[model samples]
Target: MRLSIPIQSHYYERKRIMRLFEAKNLTKKYDKTVLDHLDFSINEGEVVGVIGVSGCGKSTLARLVSGIEKPSSGSLLYQGKPVDFKKGRKDIQLILQNSIESFSPRMKIRVFLYEPYHYFYHLHKNEALDCIKKILKQVGMDESCLEKYPHELSGGQLQRIAIARALIIHPRLLICDEITSSLDHVVQREIIELLKKFVEKNHISILFISHDLSLVHEFCHQVLVLNNGKIIEKGTIQQLYKSENEVVQNLLKAAYLNS
Candidate 1:
């Protein structure tokens, strides 16, 4: 299964605003400790980035937030109430890193896009088609691919379409799990630009998880450096660069050097 999000994350204190999604003492264990009382939040209309090494529980956190998996011993609150995955899912959308397996092999692009519309809004085919057309164009695609299966498109095209599909239902929170990791730098920029435009136009909150520090720095307003299931560092891009923590310092060095 792909990563889903809201992560019951913790929002910081700079703005003193209420959290859109907040994770309190979140802990998950699979074979061993995956998350250990982790804490973070996302405010309304904010883009919060989570950066960490591979297998560092980033995906686990995403799953918990998205309701794909539940927290072992913690509370996930949305707007001061316990999040109801059944209804909360409508307001949260997740875009995974794997665009290839994102859809069913038997389904056409049309069916995939229309499912959310029908399920959530009960929109008729014609109404859904209209919205899909607009979203497709927004994600730099068109209606011509409606008849084609996922295999017929390029990686970039599939990813764009995946994004369009998620945004179609107008979720308040978008969870991105390494969505750009598989694309080329150019395609990555295009997708990020599309997200930026959408965020500017909509009051959506985003939880962006990535291994690429550079990409996170370019896109997120604030970031948390995840390590051993806890946030070791949290701040703006510029502030992070000035971190005195050794782990943060080494991570910055490695990320920039590889970039």
Candidate 2:
């Protein structure tokens, strides 16, 4: 006798712009592997938190997904198709923690914002400047920032400006690699709130990478726990909080109970 299992009708109801299947086994060095084997899926418009220890390769995984770094031997499928680094999808963008280094020391801040449009949309100088001003305003940065250099701004301001540049392109998948780690707690909260608002309004998918599990819990719908490049645990925010894994338990304790 054969038996058929029933499927939930609503399981396939939601729409997704991109999905990462497996995302496994990224071996950086033969002797000391960075990511042993990892797995997670991010639905469109979902905020996926990546939480792990300092050396667990959380940022490395973000780079891999953004095509900034190549995985040694693992497959990453974006929208069910394999990720091709050489011919990368233009809709993906990465916001690194140290936004200062990401910018050119010689260029003005406005150039940083307009350059992407000049490449992708062929917008003229005046049009690009207007677009840049609009995005900078959206991120709570003043027009005066457009004339300043990276050295002229504070760490928090630079980070916000960097985020504005990333959002200016209206990317579908935004990879944030510890983007607010250096900011003050107040600024951090504000930045997170701004990003959340953008995601809600634009339907953008976010892979937020951070070592702070508490922050992740407050922001993401689902969380992926990484240690030495392996996914020790992964589930919804509630499930992760109630997880029994020692590393996760300890991290949560340190962030909340211990602190």
Candidate 3:
């Protein structure tokens, strides 16, 4: 777990594209350091995939970027300025793998979906539902879904609903943490396709964190290999395959075996 390979990513040299999120010397800790000093940047309209073993700080990194948790040191900049979660919370959104837990059992789908509109736009109930219905269409859902409770829907259905809720806010950055891993393969592809279409028309960027290397390779514009709380390697999937670093090779081999 103690491997230190030099940062070999080509992302740092890019000057033309605007960065959406950047982390420099980012570290987080509680009783011990869960995430060591790490540096990475996600560009506008880009899908960046982060892959690592369990408890390797993948989720922690997501939290830091979304401002759910603060780094013990270093900084996270959004659009070239320090992330100001207090005034601009709506600009960043996070969704997790456990989609059902994100909603309340007591509330119907419509009620859950109404929250962002009410909180962000201060829309009335009627107005909120109007907007929610429109956004549900974008996520491939309909009015029938609005009446159901979280417990009534299948995992895939609820995940899509969660996505609709998040996107309803039009967040500039979306932190998707293992969002598709628990679903069946077909549903996973459907969710990703929905996101792809959304990105095609919107300026949003996504930090897609997952252990599914194949999905990462296929979906992300760039892939980062995280080990021991640091990015040991980063490149396009094709380039990462040709990496000479033993750590990256071992991770790729293990993922191949598991898949």
lDDT of 3 by residue, 57-151 (tens): 89999999888888999999888899999866888999999998888888999889888888888999997877887888888887898899999
Error of 1 at 229 (Å): 1.0
* CA-lDDT, candidates in order: 0.85, 0.78, 0.85
Better of 1 and 2 by lDDT: 1
lDDT of 2: 0.78
lDDT of 1 by residue, 165-190 (tens): 88988888999999999999889879
Which 10 consecutive residues of model 3 have the lowest summed lDDT? 1-10
TM-score of each: 0.92, 0.88, 0.92
Ten residues in a row with the worst lDDT in model 2? 1-10
Q: Candidate 1 clashing pairs?
A: 7-65, 8-22, 8-23, 9-40, 9-41, 10-40, 10-41, 11-41
Question: Model 3 TM-score?
Answer: 0.92
Rate residue 178 of model 2 by lDDT: 96
| Candidate 1: 10-residue stretch with minimal lDDT | 1-10
lDDT of 2 by residue, 13-37 (tens): 5654455433645555446788775
